[model samples]
Target chain A: MKPQRCVAEGLFEWPSDEPTVSGSRCDSCSFVTFPTQDACPRCGADATTPTQLARTGTLWTWTRQRFQPKNPPYIGTEPANEFQPYGVGFIELPEGRIEARIAGDIDQELRIGMPMELTVVPFATDADGTEVLTYAFRPIEG
Target chain B: MDDVAIIGVGLHPFGRFPGTSAIEMGAKAARLALTDAGITWKDVQFAFAGSYEVDNPDAVVNFLGLTGLPFTDVYNGCATAASALSQAANTIKLGEYDIGMAIGMDKHLPGAFAADPVQYGVPSWYGETGLFLTPKFFAMKIQRYMYDFDITPPTLARVAAKNYRNGARNPNAFRRQELSEEAILQSPMVNDPLTQYMFCSPNEGAAAVVLCRAEIAHQFTAAPIYLKASVVRTRRLGAFEVHSPWVPPERADSPTVDASRAAYEIAGLGPEDVDVVQLQDTDAGAEVIHMAENGFCKDGEQEALLSARGTEIGGSLPINTDGGLISNGEPIGASGLRQIHELVLQLRRAAGDRQVPGTPRVGYSQLYGAPGTAGVAIVST
Candidate 1:
């Protein structure tokens, strides 16, 4: 098996059995944000603490990306002709609402208020054969 | 501060011009506005140029015969024209210049605007994972709005159909052909809720407006449209907007809401005082949402208002009389100015086939940009 690397360095924990996204919580306002803000976006308070985000959430809203995005940034391992559409939306977790790629079968029906769980997914393989991984939300199974 | 009025307005048809460059298109609009204002370019004191794809908008002064006037280039994503217009109006209001011009021009590649997230302060990983899709953001916003407001797909289709119908009447519109609601609904889906026909394409075009103090306005035209208010705002924390990777669960007012509120306050008028409006319709869903954001209607009332034909040219409130961005493909920098051009024409009763009945006295225009910027302006005859 090949070793995988997180798509973004400090975005989420990787190379472990369980992965969680890193976030920032304001000490003064109790406001939480994703991707770790240096200063609190809400109250502009600098006293913040690094916190791990909730793994499960509810689907707030969603849409199917029926077309291939422009390249340069949307680099995929597959050829352009083989590009497949996917789901994307904001998931309402206890801490905050975060936009994420919804990982699953593209044809799967998505409904608002449905339970979703965050997990690591393969995005693409770089030229060096390192598997690029990103976080995505999937429907939580019973 | 002295009041400012738009002495002249011009638009070089909003569509693809294969053989033309952005500079040529912009120059044409500038010359037309100068001619309409009955003044030469030499008489212009200061100028502000807005553009996205164009390398040098200030270079347009060369085509108009440079008189060593101060020309500044500005870019504010989709709100480019709003920023230009606001600054131009301010120059005249502060008694700095008697006559000034605001112009915007752009030639864009076809399809969805390919915006660089990193340039906009967004992380590269967001774009790499396909989470940076602009259309998807619109779709999700509309989708959530629908869930909250009980808006249906048919209601969204109706908005597109109305804009297309209006576009068919405007000669300057890019997609001038009228599309039936069925046709719009049946169009290929770009995002889950928004179809291809509902989305505006990025194309080439230019628009310009010449402004002068209201007290000296009669020197140019008999009926000068007054610039009552011009305001621009950006989104605050917790506001849902394009390119936001995360949002606090507690909602905040969008830029559209704040800009429109300030514009109305400055103009000393509410939505009822306006006879015509030009809200940003980057997509069909956007128009529906902006109508409420601009305080034209209560939230979730778009379905009834749209069904009642309230937004039609002959309806109680006419919106996008010149077909809007849906009809005139978005030229980024040029889009907001194009809205002003249409409003000016409506106030002057110069809108031939698309003129709203019962002499319109007040006109309003608003444009929302990527990430979080918004601009709003109110004009009166």
Candidate 2:
């Protein structure tokens, strides 16, 4: 089996237990963004540096995607018959908040303000059979 | 500066018309608007057409005539008509033209609106992970709103039911049949907190209006609804909107707030003075949230307001009197103009069955859409 890798290059990496999504933090406004963009969203300053986001955050808002999304954009490899509904939410990190898929808990168990930690999950397989991993937030066990 | 007024308005019924192309529908609407204004196409000085699927909306003029008038195409997501109207009004207000036209038409496949993430300035993986869905954006926003405002799910049901009921009465409406509140609540859940019936599908339609200097409006029609104001505003930083990858913790008001405030100031009127309104009901929650954002009500008042049928045609301040997007089936560009068409009909007392009870002197319409943009228009006797 080939080794697993992050879905997008430089989005996030799980080298060890400490996992975080990589993004840019603006020096002018201290604003943070995921998938690492060039300019600050708040201040439009290009002076920014790459930084890993918070490892844990609270659920800001969430919803269960009860239906399968249209394709071309939705690249999940789940079979049509076996597709599972999932939770999607904005995780409130100290730097700001980032949208991510919610995992490890049933849809009903997800709630606003719940503690969550970053983790990696299988999204799809690459052409070379490499497992494509994406970052998701699972509920933190109390 | 010349004050603008809508001399005439028309609509190509907002349901599915399989054989009709979007441009054909647009041409039909333009011709209807011309006839309604008691003028001919040759009389149009300039025109603006709005559409999503039709890249060259300027081509619509080919069907109308080859009079060689300067034509412009506009595409502003759901606020396309409002943008078109604002530009057309401003053109006349600028003393450039006395008679101009604003029109919108669209034929969308039946489903939730889908788009490439790159088109909206987001990463491809955002959609690949299925987080780019439009309905989820509404659901999450409303879930948080309801939680903070102490609103129950039943309030959503009431909003849907009221709009559907109003749609049922409007012949041009796409969904011309009333839906029970119980059935709406029991429909299949597409996203958390929003059922299938709670959302409006993108469908086909066209709407158009002819504008002239307010002084000359009476030459075309005896009952001219003066275009008191038209304004469009983009979302400020921290405002939550569709296709957002992230939102700031310190939230800002949606663009509708600014547009609404500017519109009221320009019109020199307040919500209380407005006799009728048409707001975006992309989903039930949108209408509810807009009521507060537009200053029609305060936070957490929708539950009581909707229960009393406050937004009904016979109520204090009717909203979505033409069934809104919930009944009209959003045709992107045409949706805003459809609101104007309904308002014109109501203000003129020509809306046979769906007219508001009183002689509504003031009518308002607001359109909000993707990338966080808002357009507002106010018309009155």
Candidate 3:
């Protein structure tokens, strides 16, 4: 089974460039939070105008889910037959923090404050094979 | 020492009462407090009520009518009641009022957790995907912490086991069935690394306290406890976007540390002086770190504390003598005040079955909201 889709469905896809992950910039404090907001939680500033996110950022921290998630979360009518553990991490952007799912197994030597780049990958595929894409981070192989 | 006396304390038992509302719970707690104080409702010079959900306007008006008292409402997520405590203390200390009352109450049901969306801007992926639920989000933290600290599943399960064992003896607790560490570990994992038993029960309950001038407390009751220290802090005002490393130096006298320090300074005591404590254990992992952050132990030593049984009723700290949220259940706003209520009982040596040995002189309670919001206080008998 695929992962469960989000309730608030929007046309979210990253454009390849400096601002990789799309998000709104808080006009008041200049703080950036993902999944967009009307006002900046930081300075209580208005973020009416959302700017694209910086694609390239550093990995502040990361963790992986060793098991399946609950309903309204896990994809399909039934649980996945095989659990494929996935890595998730905090990508440090200039505006704020953005967490992304990871693609491909990387070396285990990952450490805090490592440089990373944002990329788009399949978040989950629906029953009809409709692929939903979401942002992901990978080490910027030196 | 300035004698801080609670002339009144009130409570609505922890349980599932679906028909009850947070507003009703708050009012109930306040009404009971008025009676407990042995003073007319009109005697309360100021009032502060703790609530998380803003849906109930009646809660405010009803309490106002019940006592004809003019007061403010405080909301700090799970720390609502504790925040109210600090607010009332500040008001009383300013000589604005001779008597103050604080109440906490919530009526929440079991369901997938969701919070008010980030209305100010586009929500984070967490908000959009609904990954921001407290249990789910904290599960992520627990998973990370386990790996970093090399903590085993049984070690975490021991916390729930200990709380349940004591909770069974408290008539007011939600889940009083004593559970073993194996049972908690075997329960279905809500999120990886966190089991259903490890999560706080969705409960409906209320708790209240009445504060009077320190010097006059003995007149109300021979065993009036004194408030030693109170502190409340919010995430650095404009640091929401700042992550762990980029955050500013915590405010001088920040709410979390500052409140406890003030408590110790005012009481002329330290963490070492505390005989009993009630920590804000909204989540199992939170209890671990909060105990360390609150100076119960050094950072990363909480797992050891659990292993050594140092947090048990007769252990070195005797923290959370009331079974904590994990067993007593969390009614959001009421949780903070409930901790204080627990401390009061322990300090007075009135706790029946789960009482910590000795007449506790100084007791502490610390509550937290999300990552950065926290409140702490120390009380003495």
- Steric clashes per prediction: 0, 0, 24
lDDT of residue B33 for candidate 2: 89
Among the numbered candidates, top lDDT falls to 1
> Among these predicted structures, which one has the highest DockQ?
1
lDDT of 2 by residue, B50-114 (tens): 99999987788789889999899999988899999999999998998899999999999887777
lDDT of 3 by residue, B1-381 (tens): 584577777778888876777777777777777786787667778788776664442354564475566678777766677788988888888876889888777777565445533432234444433234455555655665666666667777888888888788888899889888888899976655678888787578889899998988877788888887787766554232212212221223224555566566766788898999888666677677567667778756777889999889999888778889988888878898888888888877888998898667888898766545677888888
Note the residue pairs that clash in candidate 1.
none
Which stretches in model 1 have alpha-carbon errors above 4 Å? A27-30, A45-47
Ordered from best to worst TM-score, the candidate numbers read: 1, 2, 3
User: After superposing candidate 2, which stretches have Cα over 4 Å from the reference?
Assistant: A1-3, A77-79
Q: How high is each candidate's TM-score?
A: 0.97, 0.97, 0.79
Backbone clash total, candidate 3? 24
RMSD of 2: 1.5
Recovery fraction of native interface contacts for candidate 3? 0.07
Question: Of the pair 1 and 3, which is ahead by DockQ?
Answer: 1
Q: Of the pair 1 and 3, which is ahead by lDDT? A: 1
Worst 10 residues of 1 chain B by lDDT: B111-120
